[model samples]
Target: MTYHHTQYLEDGSIASTLADLARAHRILELEGHGDMSMGHLSYRDPFGRGLWLKRGNLALSEVVDDDFILIDFDGNVLEGTGLRHIEWPLHAEILRARPDVNFVGHSHSHFATVLASSTEELLPYNNHGIWFAYEGVPRFADTCHIITTVPLGVDAAKTLGNAQALFLANHGIAFVGSTVAEVTLTGIFLEKAARFQVDLKSSGFTPILPDPEEAKEKFDRIYPPKAQHNFWTFFNRRLDRVEALQGIGISQISLPSAV
Candidate 1:
């Protein structure tokens, strides 16, 4: 699983992709994915070498294109330099298990983690929940320990199955998708949907969930490739405004209309 060449490091396309990955980190941070540098994201290398993981010791907001290290499925660092996260196997095994998944993210966002500790299911209560309506979010209660080993990673991946996301019981969340836009939005929407469920329960009202068939139809109509691209664009624009208001420099990353 080791790759020798570092030629991809200089590839402009790869650099741009990493830049988008970095933006995803920061965007998620703004949307409550910030857990004081504990969470991480990964992109399956275009060259088939390995995944480019966010190096440890930095908060999600602190990540940039140069902050990633290329590591193989065996957890060996193949390129770049930094202390790797102990949870590398979480990203490695998921990407290895899902050929259609190019991007993966793990975070301890408040609501999602809160809902993960409860027995209630995530229903299609709103648009945010609609994305996951077809394949309900599954829970992985195997162990709360860090997924640092191959077997544990494999088991977590098994729990994930065909779902776009998984709840790691009382731990955090793991989400995967085919592109950066899809994965990042999935994380954001999952958190929002969980927050709504938590609030609904606190209100002591029995919430009505949308019909399964109707939810599946809505999911198909609203989550097409073009819609995904539009959602990503909206978030990037929102991020731009946030940076402006905070007096932070705009990201130099040349984001594409779609990832």
Candidate 2:
């Protein structure tokens, strides 16, 4: 457990806000019931440079301020005890190409994983699926792995462009957001959409794609910015309580472990 972000907030500035956002995604990755220590949530530092991201494959239930790895925009491990996620390139690659993006969340969520196992787009059955991506999703069918190599991740990022979500075929899910809270909610809704897709497939009713106008209308409202922040606000307070109970102090969290 090499914890890079020991203080939770670098300065007293945005301390509570930053910790809440960090803890929100980690908690969702835990409560959304995904496999722990595998998925992650990340956000670019606004009012500054560098990024705050999860050190991959750590137990979500055990996530502390130290588990958050702060890195430069260029993917340097700016601070933290543990090595960055092997897929760090993807985070930098996407953020560099899309400045409008504030956060990116990825997970090997169950329903989305099924699509990764197939050769199909996770199309919208209604407004819920389209709420994140105004202009339908872009599925990268290429054969790449881990985003370990720099150029490989860049090319994939180029293919992504402005889409809110990209279903990486034979891989996993990528969600872009205007904030950590937005992306976190996107992950929740994405999994919900996925579960609905799976259930509909089981029910044998053809999904009626929403009209373009309707899709645009819905995307703007469902989990809007304020609502996203509000949900994160509530969720992270619960997490902070847990963090307090565990006594996740800088001394305990700052040291690195096997990870």
Candidate 3:
């Protein structure tokens, strides 16, 4: 059953989770990682049977304390401020498909869009891009308008199986992380990697590559995203201060409100 939003304010427990998500979204928006309101970021609350999320659109910049909407594993609006993201399935299904994840960030990053429009994988063009080494990126060349259906989200997530990132044809890229910080940072890093590739292509020069073992070592350093689950907590406290000044005072963080 869908968790309908009526008159329930996110309690301290749930509010803490929303605090993290809203702060993270604000950071991504401020960084100009994606267009305004075009990208979506979500985190699964540790409570509410682990079927709750903090998402939908409500101006990432203005989102403040306890302004995150909670949803089920099925993308149905449970509690928050607005309608779910157009590609709600993209976040819900993938989270369901992969129990290991807590954060899912979807955006039409400029560099990612450029690379997505191509048939190539994001190769390691520098020490930064070394993350995409021999581990080629998977592409979803469907050119579909939007992933509004569960099946579509499932298919796309499957295509991205076991990969750190994905390049969606004629669209953009998707980066998944176990935490909000990691997911947000990975999205940024992937764009950097894509930009490196684009620059090299423009110069018509082959960029030097790092050795396999060396790349693996770097990968391990960035792994576990700061002790697994802790990454989410780190950003939660960091963003709370920013949201407080935005005037997003206490309110029923209804789905429609936060969304």
Candidate 4:
């Protein structure tokens, strides 16, 4: 992962942040967040310029540090090359609303999108589901269309409130956190939790959810800051193995050849 020194990447901290953002893109892609080139991730500029977003026209798996463009709240690309995602406001207004958040990610993960289209709430049937059990995952029902306007973004942010993640009705999911690891993990776990509920429904078996107090207690004991760091480290190592296999000429995917 050689980072080319660009105007934004010249700053060590900014470079490292974007590097993490890029890695997060790939990590989420591996964890079932890929939807062609539609999804995106962003980092709030430390200097207060705006959010440094993953540029458009690239899939999550293909995002490198150089693929970012620094865009202000008004959709102005202040730095870097490539076109900015029209959903820039999705990141902008969230950062504006949540002073504590520094990272934002949006993706149409499979199970999450399925759960979003349905009225079913995410249950704490698994460890992954417990992360959002206390705050409760809220659905942004204002619109299922792309969040391209400031007002729409603001509405989405309002729906998000202080929760770590939001399900966009019939669309995707939005997740925010104070760091890249937390944001990325939110995206990953949200998808996993959604999958659990969706699959449990498909199994035709009633799910026995944990008590709310017990779930919150487990979340506190298991999801400490150190656990988040450890999970991030594990994902990075997993990514390393995948990339190493690709380096050896193994394809990340395989399909039967057409007749």
Instruction: TM-score each candidate.
Output: 0.89, 0.78, 0.75, 0.91
Model 1 misplaced stretches (Cα beyond 4 Å): 1-12, 247-259
Worst lDDT 10-window in candidate 3: 1-10
**What is the C-alpha lDDT profile of model 2 across 126-224, one tens digit per residue?**
545776546556766776465667786787788788887777776777788776566766776676677667777777777776677776777677656
Model 4 stretches astray by more than 4 angstroms: 1-12, 247-259
> What does candidate 3's lDDT look like per residue over 97-182, in tens digits?
77777778777766777888877667765755765664557887765567788888888888888776777788777777765566
Q: Tell me how candidate 1 scores on lDDT.
A: 0.84
The candidate with the higher TM-score, 1 or 4, is: 4
**Which 10-residue window of candidate 2 scores lowest in summed lDDT?**
250-259
The candidate maximizing lDDT is 4
- In what order do the candidates fall by TM-score, top score first? 4, 1, 2, 3
Model 3: residues with Cα > 4 Å off, grouped in runs: 1-13, 48-59, 133-136, 222-259
What would the per-residue lDDT of candidate 1 be over residues 171-249, giving only the tens digit for each residue? 9999998888899999999998988887787888888878899999999998898788778877776765776666332
Q: How would you encode candidate 4's per-residue C-alpha lDDT over 1-259 as one tens digit per residue?
A: 4222232223459887798788899989888888888899999999999999999999888887678999887889999999889999999999999999999999998888888887888878899999897888899987779899999999999999999999899999999889888999999999889887877877877779799999999999999998988788788778778876663212235322211
Report clashes for each candidate as comma-separated counts: 0, 5, 14, 0
Higher-TM-score candidate among 3 and 4?
A: 4
Which of 1 and 2 is ahead in TM-score?
Answer: 1
